[model samples]
Target: MIPTNLVVHQQSKVLELTYENGSTYCLPFELLRVLSPSAEVQGHGPGQETLQTGKRDVLITSLEPVGHYALKPTFSDGHDSGLFTWDYLYKLCENQEQLWLTHLEKLAAAGLDRDAPMTKQGHSCGSH
Candidate 1:
């Protein structure tokens, strides 16, 4: 389902989406950045996904519509490859809690802090 309205609340750091069915989801900027669907984050194959860290302060610098199906967001962290499709976004809204929990679990398993900076090797830097 497509969103009827989308509002970016800079103060709250959330992207609020309102659907035709009157359902609204407030997605945090951090969540959106860490969970980006871009290949840079998701990788091109299974087990190659890059775990994101230090995104608690990431911001949506700009957002643009992509054709009639998706949105392209340029994050303050310089991530702009993820094209958030309508269906994908709806799913994110529906499954936010579970997805977030899973992400946390993965981070814990990797012994990485959500607010820790990533190193050049795409892993969290313990020095920081």
Candidate 2:
């Protein structure tokens, strides 16, 4: 379903999408940034996907349409390569919970945090 409306809630740091199917999805800015479909994040092939960390405070700077198919979101971190198509947005909405849990699990296993990276001494090095 195509989104009928979109709102960027800066205060809440979420991008809300209202679809024609009456489904409203509120995706966090950080989630969108980390899960970006950009080659920088997804890489060029399978198993080359990069795990994103220290993105808890990241925010969307802007969003522009790419034809009628997708949105290109500019992030504060200077990443703007992702093309979030309607189908991909819907998929993210449907799998948000599971995906978020999976991300958290991966972060934990890697000794990382959403807000910062772990150092060799087990302390937060910084947001990277």
Candidate 3:
């Protein structure tokens, strides 16, 4: 399930992943950052997940491989904790559109904007 090739296009702000199955996925840096499977973003458990905002322009600065199963992407915003596992990455590619829409819904439900920072009184902001 590991990607055969992982290309980070900084200028385009996207990550192009090619799998062994000959499938390719073009994932935007923003999307990856927002949906990062890190404790910072996903929190420690269900219902504690944090919604990431204002990441529409984020970019991956570097991608370092972790063993032979995952990648650690350091984003321009300084977020590098999320380790994208092979299977996890494949899941992201498989459910791209639906996940995006769900994220959008979460944003709207919180009266937040994809292009705006989460600055409401008690909300945890992801701005860096």
Candidate 4:
């Protein structure tokens, strides 16, 4: 199904999308970054998922359509591997609030912070 409406609010860094099926989704830039579908994040196969850190401030710099069904989202941090398909994007949008809460919970449980700094040694330096 095609998206009937796609509104990108640059100021708020939110993408509000509405599908032809009457489903609406609101996706935040930061959420898209942390949940990127790239192999770097999702891994090459099952059970290799990598949780992203220090992405709380990540922002969407641009959004380009890859085709009728997906978008290549450019991030301010120079990450652009994820090709967000319409269906997948819709799911993210729909689950935005709950997913964000879950992300925060996971971070806390792991003794990590989304905005933590990375040291020169390539390790995150902050309260965990």
Error of 1 at 69 (Å): 0.3
**Tens-place lDDT digits, model 4, residues 8-108:** 77788777888778887778787888888887667667856556787766777888999687998888888788999977887787788888888788779
Candidate 4 C-alpha error for residue 20, in Å: 2.8
What pairs collide in candidate 3? Answer: none
What lDDT tens digits, residue by residue, belong to model 2 across residues 1-128? 67899999988999999987788999998888888998777876886666788777778898999998999999987888799998998888889988899888877887777778523322132423
Show the colliding residue pairs in model 2. Answer: none
lDDT, residue 91, model 3: 95
Residues 1-128 of candidate 1: C-alpha lDDT, one tens digit per residue: 99999999988999999999889999998888888998888877789889999999888999999999999999998889899999989989999999999999999999999999976654333421
Displacement of the residue 45 alpha carbon in candidate 4, Å: 2.9
- Of 3 and 4, the candidate ahead on lDDT is 3
TM-score of each model, in listed order: 0.93, 0.87, 0.90, 0.79
Q: Which candidate is the best by lDDT?
A: 1
lDDT of 3 by residue, 1-128 (tens): 87888888888888999988899999989999999998878977788877888888888888999998899999888889999999989999999999999999998997878888745334354544
Ranking by lDDT: 1, 3, 2, 4
| Whole-model lDDT, model 3 | 0.87
Candidate 4, residue 32: how far the Cα is off, in Å = 0.9
Q: Taking the candidates one at a time, how many backbone clashes does each contain? A: 0, 0, 0, 1
Specify the poorest-scoring 10-residue window by lDDT in model 4: 119-128
Candidate 3 has its poorest 10 consecutive residues by lDDT at 119-128
